[model samples]
Target: MGISDTSTGILKGLVVIAAVFIVLAGLKTATNILVPFLLSVFIAVICNPLIAKASEYKIPKALSVTLVIVLFLAIALSIAGLVGNSLNELSQQLPQYRTQLNEEFAWVTNKLAEYNIAISSAVLIEYFDPAAAMGLAADMLSGLGGVMANLFLIIITVVFMLFEASSLPKKLHYALDDPEMRLSQIDRFLQSVNHYLAIKTVVSIGTGVAVSLMLWVIGLDFFLLWGVLAFLLNYIPNIGSIIAAVPAMSLAILQLGPAAAGGIGLGYMVINTVMGNMIEPRFMGRGLGLSTLVVFLSLIFWGWLFGTVGMLLSVPLTMIIKIGLESSEEGRWFAIMLSSDDDVEKYHTAK
Candidate 1:
């Protein structure tokens, strides 16, 4: 007798689940090698526009790639050196900072007691500890510093990728059957990714610069380090800005005072509000189209799988999977579940 349709569907579902489990296992085991390759791909995508611009000016492809790589390498090395030194100093000073934070907490508790507010210092601390924020900052930056260990490999990979990027469309054109349909899908996906990253990178740079200037003006230590941190974490969405702000605010509390810390916090709010809510929306239109829950869940999941690099590249990696799923009819429903309601509405509207 032929297999029942329900039985066949259940078997196919099990097969899909098994395949995902195997793929995730492989990715986790290969993270050390995969992380650098992924970072290279990200760098290559961001640098492609620079190469294209140079090519438009009649620059040779090899020379243009060389120039772009050299420029990026110089900048990357400078950031690594600066951030490394800053991290070492910060790590050494963390105990002192924590002590000072405790003193601040005690002082506040005493002041509150004088007013008969009756809040226990321990309870207050349990609910709010700025030092914890500093620890998070340290962890995030250290992860970035770790990536620099594989700098040579990543740069070389980026150089080759950038060189290949120009001719990739042509290569695919001849290689794929049904070039019209397949190429169109691939082209749309790449274009969407490129557009999103390019805009995000520009906004991140602006956020970093604005943050550095604000902290510098407020006389906070490690303004540049904090600025770079802001630039990197700004990619994470929702919580990224909050995470970036805390360490700077905590440092301000230690080095400057509560007033300066408050100023730094407010500055962060303003910068993120303008960049994320105003500027990005104007430039990006509807943003990445992924739901908020999806971004947050992916952040934790990818972070677990790939460590820091995974967290940093979570959105892009998820987008790649989502778009790939979207390209196949069988997976379109899953893609919709991953997307924002607005995107779902648009999908149905288009249908």
Candidate 2:
């Protein structure tokens, strides 16, 4: 390229990068307030299915909302209870685990002795130090505190959002003074969101159950944890399964020793490969279309902007953005670029 063109390209790239950073900083700031509300809205959408089913049984709308809310809260409390019990049990076993770890370290040192690695137990202990491990535990607890706080805020937001959900469209319509058109747009937006959620929920649950069963049969330390990871990560397209597998494999190695760990890791790899590469593609089809590049870039963008939770929500959030863009004439090209080529062709042919 010519110098002038190269210089222009460099300048444009810098400007774009600066703009992206500014937007990311704004998003990070907004997330403190927006995350809880967005989470609540998503929860309300999931519960809408149950609410509709209840309406089919001739239940009043208000009563159906109330019923779903109660059921949701009950499930939340039960999960909290289970997590609490698990935490307590883990705390009690901590010392025993530490001892086991020390023994394992010594065993490793002994085995290495045959290789002429004359490492003393004390030296090995120093190298394999538990102090850093303790520090990690502390950090984890601090993170857990933040997560729990976020969880409580999310629940509060969800309750209020659920209470006001049915009236929201009407309120917006009245305020806009174009009730029918506004309501129609709102309805379409909601339908798109609901469709995305339904597909995501089914896919995530299926992946989680499959992973959990595999882990359980293989005698992994925490099948449930891996299952939960699978479910949460399934929302992230392309790389989520890989990210989820790392912790599962690492923890397996720590708990089950290398041979068993290898087996567990292989199981995870196989399951994820089949689900992520093959089955998911077949099932997702073209309706909630997203491009491979869009999916990968969304992972990096959202993950950088909002941490682990953002990574988990990346694809859905991107899909939602794509849907919004698709709904507008001027932005249709952007939406098309975000979709699979196959889907774009289908859309064009249908048009």
- Against the true structure, what is each candidate's TM-score? 0.86, 0.78
lDDT of 1 by residue, 1-351 (tens): 256988998999999999999999999999889999999998887888888898789989899888888888898888878888887887788778767767878898899889888877778667656557677887887787788889999998998898788789888889987777777877666677788888888999999999999988888888899999999898886788889998888788877778988988889999999999999877664647788799899999989998878887888888888987987898999999999888899899989
lDDT, each prediction: 0.85, 0.70
Among all windows of 10 consecutive residues in model 1, the one with the lowest summed lDDT is 124-133
- Which candidate comes out best when scored by lDDT? 1
lDDT of 1: 0.85
- Model 2: per-residue Cα lDDT over 36-140, one tens digit each: 666676787778767778778998887877778778879666645554554565556556656776788789888999899887777755654433433432333
Cα miss at 117, model 1 (Å)? 12
Q: Count clashing residue pairs per candidate.
A: 0, 0
The parts of candidate 2 lying over 4 Å away from their true place are 1-23, 119-153, 167-189
Stretches of candidate 1 off by over 4 Å are: 1-3, 92-133
Best by TM-score: 1
lDDT, candidate 2, residue 115? 96
